[model samples]
Target: MTRIASCQCGQLSLTVEGEPALVSACNCTRCQKRSGSAFALSSRWNSNQVRDRSGKGLTYSRKGASGGNVLFEFCPVCGSTVSTSLELLPDVIGIPVGCFADPAFPAPKVAAWCESKLEWVRFPDGLLLLRDQTQPMDTR
Candidate 1:
C-alpha cells in the first residue's frame, strides 16, 4: 500500500510505499511545541521508501532532548511540518502522522518521554510507555 502525507497548503508532500517501520509518540517539550499539541505522533520510514517529494520545504534545525540535532522540513506556504530527519538515525525519515490526515492511520506503538507528559495524557493498553528517552523505540 502507498500513503501520501502533505502539508495544509498542499505545497509539500511525501509519497511513501508500504507500511512504516515504526510509529511512535513523543511527549518531550520540543515535540509539544513543534506539534502544538500534548505530544507528537510520528512514523518512521526508510529514506528509500519516500518515492516522491513535492515542492520545496523550509528547513529548521534544533537540538533534541537526546542531544542530537533534529532537522524539520515544513511547507513554506502553510508552515505545516512535512517530515523530519534525526542525526541519530540518518537513514530514517520521520513524518508527522497527522500530516497523513487519515483516521485509519496506525496507532503509535510506543510513547516516549512520559516524564514530560501532561497529567491527563494516556495511551492505549499494550502500548510501550517509557518514562524518559532512555530507551530506544525500535528495540523490537
Candidate 2:
C-alpha cells in the first residue's frame, strides 16, 4: 500500500510505499518536547521505500539517548515535524504517525524510553515497553 504523510501546512509531503518495518512510540524528553505530547509515534521505512517526496523542510539534529544524532525534518512554514533519520539507523527514515492523520494507520507495537514516560500515560495491552532503546531499529 502507498501512504502519504504531510505537515500541518501541507508544505512537506512524504510518500511511503508498502508497509513499514516498525512502528514505535518514544517517551524520551526530546520526543515529548518535539511532539508536544506524551510521546512521539513513528513508522520506520527504508529510505528507498519513500518516493515522490516534496518539500524544502529544515532539518535539526540533536544528540539522541544512544549518543548518536537524530535528525528531524520539519516544515518551515508550520514548524511541524514530518520525518526523522537517525545516525545510528542509516538508510532508514522515520515518519511521524500523526502526520498521516489516518486513524486506521498501524498502531505502535513498542514503546521506548519508558523510564521517561509520563506516570499517567498508559499503553495498550501487548505493547512492548522498553526503558531505553537497546537494539537497532531493524531488529525490533
On lDDT, the candidate that comes out on top is 1
Assess candidate 1 and give its lDDT.
0.92
Residue pairs whose backbone atoms clash in candidate 2:
none
lDDT string for model 1 (1-140, tens) is 89999999898999999999999999998899989999999999999999999899999999988889999999989999999999999999999999999999998988999878888997887889887876644423
lDDT of 2 by residue, 10-101 (tens): 99999999999999999999899999999999999999999888988999999998999999999999999999999998999999999999
Alpha-carbon deviation at 95 in model 1, angstroms: 0.4
Residue 134's lDDT in candidate 1: 64
All models: lDDT? 0.92, 0.91
Q: What is the C-alpha RMSD, rounded to one decimal, of candidate 2?
A: 3.7
TM-score against native, each model = 0.94, 0.94
Clashing pairs in 1: none
